[model samples]
Target: MPDSSAERPRRIVARREGPMLVEGPVEIVLEDGTTVSSDRFCVALCTCRRSRIFPWCDTSHRRHSPAARPAADH
Candidate 1:
């Protein structure tokens, strides 16, 4: 077995209104038992489920924002 602490840490960058950037290549298991992976040097993971490509960001979060959303009438 390998020591987890001894391994170099993977970096993740969280954006305020968008996807999180992670160092790749990474493998992920979904809630439905499906798996996904990316071999890119970096990967953008959707924090918001607005992605057409789930787990992978498609910049869909940019279409609407908390600040940009229209206010509901009282």
Candidate 2:
């Protein structure tokens, strides 16, 4: 339990157009004071506020503009 990795702080990766990644197990406190927890190895946090699950990325940001995508080649 005295490992150096254990002494290190949690790592978080942020992206402009995507979710922010954080090393888990994490507990998130929402605006209303409710707390949510996730025990997954990695967690994706919503940045664009488009997540159906809010605070947790449901990839809703990716669906922001379906029409903006180029038409598929035949």
Considering every candidate listed, which one attains the maximal lDDT?
A: 1
Provide the lowest-lDDT 10-residue window in model 1: 1-10
Q: Against the true structure, what is each candidate's TM-score?
A: 0.79, 0.78
lDDT of 2 at 11: 92
Per residue, candidate 2 scores C-alpha lDDT tens digits across 1-74 of: 13547667889998777899998888899999999999998999999898889999998887775555788999
Model 2 Cα shift for residue 19 (angstroms): 0.4
Candidate 2, pairs of clashing residues: none
Candidate 1 regions with alpha-carbon error over 4 angstroms: 1-6, 67-74
Model 2: runs farther than 4 Å from truth?
1-6, 65-68, 71-74
Residue 22 error for model 1, in Å?
0.4
